[model samples]
Every structure is written in structure tokens, then in C-alpha cells.
Target: MSYYDEIEIEDMTFDPKLQIYHYPCPCGDRFEISIGDMRDGEGVGVCPSCSLMIQKRGEASNSSCGYLNAGYFSSTISSATRDLIKTKQARHI
Candidate 1:
């Protein structure tokens, strides 16, 4: 298989409940990696149904779960992100 390409962590979505980071894969599946894995310096994201993978690149921070307490705002969520979050939440329900 060809080497996985590098993708910024900003391009991925974090599931606070699952504590996993996910990005869309070309194979109609998602590439997933964990916050713990990133903390342990494991940056490779793998697809469950395909040979594809990606290397996550970004500084590890306490706000990886998209929440911060006191004096820290990583980024604002757009309507699309809100919809995606709702969908994920619904699926988990």
C-alpha cells in the first residue's frame, strides 16, 4: 500500500464520549485515531474497512475534545459542524 498522507488534526472531528478523533476516508469509511494514542506519540489514523491511513499532525492539547475551561477557545463551531455533532449524538442514543 502507498504511504498515508499527512493531515492536520484540525481537519478531523473529536468524539468526546468515545474519545476518538475521526476523519473521512476516501473509501466511504472513516479514519480513526485516539487522543491517548496521539498523547503517546502514535499519530497514524487507520480506516477500518480499507488499507488507507493518514498521519495526524498538530500540537497535542488539552482541548482535543473540543471543550476548554477558562481562557481558552480553540475554534468556533460552524452550522455544519453543529449538524455533524448532532448526528453523532443521535446515533449514539
Candidate 2:
């Protein structure tokens, strides 16, 4: 079975401003990703550690199922955003 088979995704709103797909991770962690940026059929992203392409199950539209493995940090993202992720990770542990 593929790793994608293990992920449970909900219908999520796409954000044009960020150009990414968002989903709640199985670990209770939320991740945002850019499907357009990934190699075709190879769900991959540029997040710190998690970098892979993730696809939702049984979704006809790619917009509903395709996503990068993790969220990326660009000039658009504020340092505060990174800090918040760090904080969340700390709390999760």
C-alpha cells in the first residue's frame, strides 16, 4: 500500500494567494502545500523535514486531492509564522 493510502483528507478550501492545498495531517498536524510546484505525480514539497507529494483518495479533481508533502517558507511568510510552527511543535511534544 502507498503512504497516500494512509492519509485521510477532507474537502479543503484552496488559497490562491498562497498557491497551496491544505489538509490536516494524520498526526494532528496541519500542512499546506503547492501541488503546481511539485513534479507531475510525485507529490513533493519544500517544507523543512517532510518533502513528498501527497494525494487524497478517490478525488476526481486534482485540486481536491493533490498536495505537496509539506508547506514551504518564502519571503511572503513572516518570521512569526515560522515561530508559530516551532511553538506548535514544542507543544505537541
Candidate 3:
């Protein structure tokens, strides 16, 4: 299967609440893949607004359940991110 691009996991933004990682899509949508999908050995992130998809790479070690570790995101994410998540969650509710 071919992909529109190959992106590193570190480049994607992970949402702890949703357990999903997302990257920008030219279609004005985000390419997303859930942590469950990765743990199941699926690495493809799909854009909801288009047919384009990207391959996610860089899971060299288990993050406890076999995807990425919480620490990986922790180091990359700051408290501001948590606030953002909260704001998003509030809107969805």
C-alpha cells in the first residue's frame, strides 16, 4: 500500500484524552490514528477530508502497552497542552 507521506511519530501531536496522534492534512482536516491502532501494529494515519494517508514510524520500544510511552509525550507536551486538551474536551461535551 502506498502513502502520501511518511511522518515521524515525534512530529505528530498526541492527545492523551483521545489517545490519538494527529498531523496536519492539506485537505483542511487532520490525519489521525489512535494508540489502539498502533498497538495492534497499524501505523497508518488517515485524513478524514481526503483519501490521503501517512505512515507513522518511530515506535522502537514499548510504551508499556506496546505503542509509545507516556514519558515520550510528557517530555514533548507541556502544561499548556493539557489546557488545550481541556478546552477541546469542553467543546465536545
lDDT of all predictions: 0.71, 0.44, 0.74
Task: Count clashing pairs, candidate 3.
Answer: 0
Q: Write down the RMSD of all candidates, one decimal each.
A: 11.4, 14.1, 10.9
Q: Candidates 1 and 2: which is better by lDDT?
A: 1
Per-candidate TM-scores read: 0.65, 0.35, 0.65
Which of the predicted structures, 1 or 3, would earn the higher lDDT when compared with the native? 3
Ranking by lDDT: 3, 1, 2
Clashing pairs in 2: 43-52, 43-53, 44-52, 44-53
- Candidate 2, 14-71: lDDT as tens digits: 5646666566555555455554443134443223335433555333143323322134
- Candidate 1 per-residue C-alpha lDDT over 7-84 given as tens digits, one digit per residue, 9 for 90 to 100: 888888888656689999999999999866775678899999999999888754544644532222325546675565
Residue 90's lDDT within candidate 2 is 55
- Stretches of candidate 1 off by over 4 Å are 63-93
Consecutive 10-residue window with the lowest summed lDDT within model 3: 60-69
